[model samples]
Target: MKLVVQVKLLPSPEQAVALEATLHACNRAADRASAAAFESGLFSRNDLQKLVYAELKADFGLGAQPVVRTLKKVVDAYTALRAAIRAGTLGRPGCVRRVKAESKPITFRLDAAQPFDDRILSWQHDASTVSIWTTAGRMKHVPFRGNADQLKTLREHRKGETDLVHRNGKWFLVATCEVPEAEQYEPVDWLGVDRGIVNLATTSDGHNHCGRRLGRYRRWQARKRAELQAKNTRSARRRAKRRTKREQRHATHANHKISKEIVAVAQRTGRGIALERLDGIRDRVRPSRDQRAALSSWPFHQLGEHIAYKAQRAGVPLIEVDAAYTSQMCPRCGHTARHNRPTRDSFSCRRCGLAGPADVVAGVNVRNRARSAWVFVNTPVPQGI
Candidate 1:
């Protein structure tokens, strides 16, 4: 499993200034490389390296690795733009934004051959600090702290490149760690999980994690956001942005908690998990304006992603099945009709007279699908969200 643990850095004022200057120098180089790449119509890393490597190194007084990393960022942006254009997701290739020294994340690309074995960037075991390479041609030990779980991972499983991020007057090191995959568990039965806007998640065992509180929070945020926009003042805008970030954090934390609960349920019951295939759901449905915001704001995809990784980390079997009629189909008698779900939150099978929470019915149907497909594909495969 791959996860990023964010460790907060505590740098002295002088050290902070040096870090900021370095960030500015790197971003300036990146912007120059971006302009060159787009104007020359050459986006390959090698080509970009040839174009700006020496100039950026001498002009910005940057190291060879930082120059290469900066140019690669430009190359990656153009590459993604070209791909999106070709895939018809975008009409045309767009201009890459100039990296702002104040806001852009400064990535320290550690060489793969060297790995992160504490040479360029290493942890000081005694000081609870990290020695990071800077543009000043010296390594500075910056004290850092994090939550117990994050610190534990840094002490034990730190690996790969770390990104230095400056946000709201704080420095953070986002470090990615590679952990061994969990041992696979034999499945006893299938656990169906239905994700919806009304209820964040519904399990086949008749559990509903409702979203009323989230909905109210969103509505409140929307109103405050509108008010802030009306003010059009700098402070109001800043406040609005901060509120939005807070709301996002709340939602993300809620998702993690909900996913943890679902995984725990599956683990305790000794069952695999089955979820709806939700790819491209947003584009597939057209809702009224009144309903659109709620639907669009729904975190079904996020919930699914969280559940997937957590389930994988716990060695719980998980699979996605087609979601054609899982919502309306009768889990008890195999009856399928839109009228089965006459209301948004209620479901009744006209044929079998079986009725219950609409989400639970959907959950049951998903479980049935998993049971039917168990013979073909039995184990969970960890994949990207």
Candidate 2:
């Protein structure tokens, strides 16, 4: 398993200026490479490299590997645009946006994992600082701080190339460390997680993490934004931006707490987690304007991602089951019908007179479906059938 640990960097004023200049230079080189690729219709990494490598080093004063990284940046963007165009998600390759000189994240990729192992990033455990090569031809020592675990990794198991990034008025070093996977354990019991807009998640064991507070916060934000738009003042615009950031931070905190609780529950119960495959439910559903806003603001995907990573870190098995008919089917009697769920929160079965919270019912159904899948995968076909 590859996990990325982000360590915050504390650079001196001069070093900060040098790092910013390096970022701008890298972006300039990326823009030049992108333009050349678009004009010449050559988008391969090798083609871009052949065209811009030497020029980037000579003209932009970038290091050798940074030049390659710049060309790679442009080629990746062009490749993504071409893919989207082919997949019909985008109209044409021209729809791709140009890399901004300062807006895009500025990164300096290390030469290899050897640099990290050799203490190029962490000079030594004694110093607790990094030696970064800059355009000024100077090796700057930038102090960094992180948790004890991250610091231990930097001292011992830090592997692969590191990316030094500047974003949101701070500098960070992102390093990917290879962690060994835990021994696989077949789950004896499964914990079903039903994710939806009304209830963020409901478990088969009768835990409901409703999004009512989050919903109210979003609605308040929407109303506030509307009021600010009506005023149309510069400070109002700035306030709106600040509000957006605050909302994001709040939602992220809530998600962290919710995912932590869900994982703790699963771990304590000695059960594997089962989640629904909700890839494109938003595109499939048609709702009223108010409902649309609520649905669009739902953080189901983010919640699922948090659960997945936490589960993996905790050595718990996590499986995603097909979501089809999970809500309509009755978990108790196997009765399936749209009328089973007449309201957003209420669920009732016509065949067995079973009734419960709609999300809880869905959770139960998800657990059963996951058990079925596990059986199908584990069972072998008999010979001479």
Candidate 3:
């Protein structure tokens, strides 16, 4: 499994200046490369490199590898933009969002993170320092720190490229670690998880991680955002952007906490985890106008990703089952209908009169599906007669 370990960098003032200058130069070169790619329709890495490599190397304050990284970054940005448009998540062909996105070349922030390979960056784990290439020159012996576990992971399993990131007022080096996975054990049973807006997750075991408090927090943030937008002042706009980022961080923190707990419980009990395949959830479900705003921006996908990665790291078996009618179907009598869920949080069977919390019942259905699916996966077919 691939895990990201972030360590805080402590650099001298002179080193910081060189680092910032290098990042700015790289991003400026990337902007120019992106413009050329957009205007000339040369989106491939090779094509873009051939066109802009000499220009960036001569004009920008960057060496050979930095120029190459800048070109590759431009190509990657275009690739992602194309994919998002094709995936229908952005909108249809004639939609305003699609038109706007296609109108201009992708741009990067001046302080955007840049990838560093072994050729340009070297780590000294024993000294807790790194030496990296900079616009001024090669800056050596920049100290860094991290938690005990993070340091251990960095020393033992760090691999591939590292990213030099500047966030808020802190510098961080995000290292990729190739951690070996624990051997997966045979599961006693499946622990089904139901994801939603009101309750972030509800398991078949009757554990619910509610989102009411987070919902209130987000709503308050939204209201402040609206006010800031209405003001239309420079400081107001800046504050709004900061608030938005803070809100995202809070939501992400909540997701991490929830996923860690769920994975720990599943691993401790020697059971597999079951989740719904939420590939196109936004298109599938309909919500009231009042609820639509919350549903649209809900971090359900992030929660699922968190659970998945944590499960992988813990060697817990995980399965994703079809989510259709999970809440509406009666687990006791095998009845399915919309009427079964008269209220958002409650469920009742029309024919069998079996009732339970709607989210828990949905989780139970997911567990049942996973139990059957796992058996089928491991079962072998008899030889043809």
Candidate 4:
């Protein structure tokens, strides 16, 4: 399993400015490379990287290593942009073009041997200071500090796939890890999950996961945002930055807890979990401002990811089914009719007069669909009884 570990970067003022400049330059180069590729029929990522790396070295007077590193960064961004385009996520091509124009000059990537990694000592909790290894040698340990709770997060980077990023005047580490493929298991029972804005999630088995806890945090965030907006002073802006960081930390902690609960529940049940293919839930939901805020705050994708990884680890299966008519279908009669689901909260079948909670009905439908598919696929049944 590939995992990423992220730790804080303690760059000196001069180094920080230099790094920012490099990043901006790399972003600009990537934009140019992407545009060139789009215009020229031969715009493979390699071609773009080669072109940009040479340009940075000759035109910008960057060293060979930095030039190569920056080109890699540009390639990464290009990959992300292309993916967004392929996914139909880049709504405005013009916007992408414009962003690319500004991006080429602003962002860059660092090599694994870059001075950034040499300073830190394997990222331990007890060590209060870690140095960034630079070409000049190990930088002095800057008195870096974070809350004790963050220590737990440091240990999560088991696979060391974390990325170090400098953005918007701050440094951040992001970890990306792949969930291992699950072992073959017998498919007998399935648990369906219904994720939403209001309640967060409702399992097919009559369990409800509430978003009210996140709602409370949202309210607090709103207050903080308003407070920041009210003040135009530099001090207020600085304070706002600190507030934003604090809120992000708290939100991440909450998500970790919620995700852990979801995985725990799935593991304990020892059954496959079924979820809707929520590829475009944002557009489908078209929620109100308050609703959207709450929905955005909740980490539905993260929860799903957690469930998938944990289930895989525990040898449980996870199924993704079409959500189109799951909410409307009558679980009793398997009838796909609009009249059966008269309201958002309640499902009543017009043909059979079946009544039940809309979410519960949807969950049952999801479970049934997944089970039917599993049986049709003839996936191996788990051993034992």
Candidate 5:
């Protein structure tokens, strides 16, 4: 399994300034390339690379090597950004368009391919400090007095992180690591997953996972955002930037946790996962204004992506069945009717007089779908349903 682990980069003041400048230039180059691709009707990576490389060398007079690295990194951003846009995974294009309009003037990408060295620790821990090395020469360290759990996590998982930045002020690191696929165990009789607005997810097999706790943190963030909007002051802006960083960190943590839980459940049961195919969920979810404010704060698509990757790594097939009537279906009698789901939490089948918690019923329906698919496909049944 491919997983990314991101640790902070600690650079000297001079190096930090250079890194910031490089990121700024890279963003501008990316913006220009995106515009050029949209205009020319040739929106491929090769086209983007050509546009960014030419613009960097001719317009900016950067060296060919640096220009090449910058172009490569920008292209990676472009690929991710464009995919989000095409999949309707991001908000409107206004912010990106605005960035393109105001171009920045440095750029960098990795200039040389280097072999992985095991001696280089991804993260290091002393009595009261933790450090992570990005390259052989650059390392970032954070101070924490005493946290054994954190130290253990840092030691075991630090190597998976890679830093990537979009602009000067906006920086992020992608953390991932490869895990060997688990051997197939006893065939699974069933797997059940529950997805909802409040809790995010719970499994019938006694595992619970929260979706995005960032929504809770947003209450504290709202004040900072308001202050920034009112005064347009430097401190307020910095606070706003910090809040955004916190939100991203929270999101990454949530994704890692959810992915880990899902993979664990699949491995333990040796069962195919059953999840609702929540297509067009954003459109369907109708929350009150306050609820919408909280709901929209989380990244559901990112969670789904984590599950997909981890499931693939574990050799666990994840089935995305139609969720149209799962919530209303009577798992005991196979009675599916709209009126049976009169409330969000309660499911009462009128035909069979079978009733249960709405989420549980839905989860059972999902498991049944997976089992039925296996049966139809003539896959060997797992022992003990």
Candidate 6:
């Protein structure tokens, strides 16, 4: 499994200035390269580099590797944009967003992240410091700190390029690490997870990670964001952006905690995890205007992602089961009806008189589906079936 460990850089004031200049110079070079690529319609890495490499090195005071990295960044940006357009994620062809995106060249911020290879960046794990090449000069012995696990991972499994990012008046290096997955055990059963807006997650075992508190926090943040936008000032907009980031951080933290607990339970009980296939959920549902914002902004997808990675790290098997009618279908009598759900919170079966919390009922349905699905998945097929 590939994981990224972020380490905080503690550079001296002079080193910080050098790093900042190097980042700006690289981004400026990238902007120039991107403009050339757009005008010439040449975005291939080698082609683009051939066109602008000399200019970037000579004009931008960047070294050989920085020039190479800058050109690669421009190429990657266009490649990603093309992919997004092809996937229809930017909207259909000739639509306003798609047209606008295709019409202009991609641009990077002045403080954009810069990638460094081993030749340009050297790490001294024992000294907890790094020596990085910059436009100003090579800065050596710049201290850094991270959690014990992050430091250990960086020392052992860190590979590939590390991105130097400047955000919120701080510098961080995100290093990629490849960690081996533990051996998966045979599952005695499955733990189903139901994801929803009101309840972030509810398991088949009847444990719930309620979203009431998070919901309130988000509502408060939303109200503040609206106020800031209403003011229509630069500083107000900046504050709103910071508030948005804070909310995202909080939601991410909550998900990590919830997923860790769920994975721990599954591993201890020798149970696999089953989650719903929730792709295209946004396209499938419609809600009132008031509910639309909340529904659209919900972090249900992030919760699922957290659960998946944590499960993989813990060597717990995980699968996605069909989610169609999970909430309304009765686990007891196989009765399926929209009327089975009397309210958003409660579920009742008309045929078998079975009842439970709506979310739990959905989770139980997921577990039942996984049990049957696993049997077919693992059973060996006879010669010709």
Q: Each model's TM-score, in the order given? A: 0.86, 0.84, 0.92, 0.65, 0.64, 0.97
**How much is 114 displaced in model 1, in angstroms?**
19
Of 4 and 5, the candidate ahead on TM-score is 4
Clashing pairs in 1: none
Between prediction 1 and prediction 5, the one with superior lDDT is 1
lDDT of 5 by residue, 1-385 (tens): 4544433444556555655554455455545555665566554566656655667666644445445544555556556665766765554556775355324311323221111223332334453333332322344453333245434544555454344433344333333455556554444676777677655666656455654355566676787788787988888788788778877777778777877787777777677787878877778868887777666765666777777777777777777777778888788888878899988768899998988777777788888887887677777678997
Model 6 segments more than 4 A misplaced: none
Instruction: Put down candidate 2 lDDT per residue, 89-172, tens digits, no spaces.
Output: 644334444223212332333221111222334444567787876677555567888998887866666677776777667888
lDDT for each of the candidates? Answer: 0.81, 0.78, 0.93, 0.64, 0.61, 0.94
TM-score of 3: 0.92
**Model 5: ten consecutive residues of lowest lDDT:** 105-114
Off by over 4 Å in 1: 92-119, 137-139, 233-239, 376-385
lDDT of 3 by residue, 1-385 (tens): 8999999999888888888888899999999999999999999999999998999999997889888877888888999999999898789998899999999999999999998888899999899999999989888999999999999999999998899999987899999999998888899999999999999999999999999999999999999999999999999999999999999999999999999999999999999999999998888878889988898889999999999998998899999999999999998888999999999999989998898899999999999999999999999888993
- Measured on C-alpha atoms, candidate 3 has an lDDT of 0.93
Q: What clash count goes with each model?
A: 0, 0, 0, 28, 10, 0
Pick the TM-score winner. Answer: 6
Candidate 4: list runs displaced more than 4 Å.
7-71, 78-90, 95-104, 108-132, 139-182, 230-252, 285-298, 335-355, 379-385
Between which residue pairs do clashes occur in model 3?
none
Error of 5 at 264 (Å): 1.1
Which run of 10 residues does model 2 get worst, by summed lDDT?
110-119
| Every model: Cα RMSD to truth | 6.0, 4.7, 2.1, 6.7, 7.6, 1.3
Model 2, residue 378: distance off in Å is: 0.8
Between candidates 2 and 4, the one scoring higher on lDDT is 2
TM-score of 1: 0.86
- The per-residue C-alpha lDDT of model 3 at residue 34 equals 92
Per-residue lDDT of 119 in model 2: 30
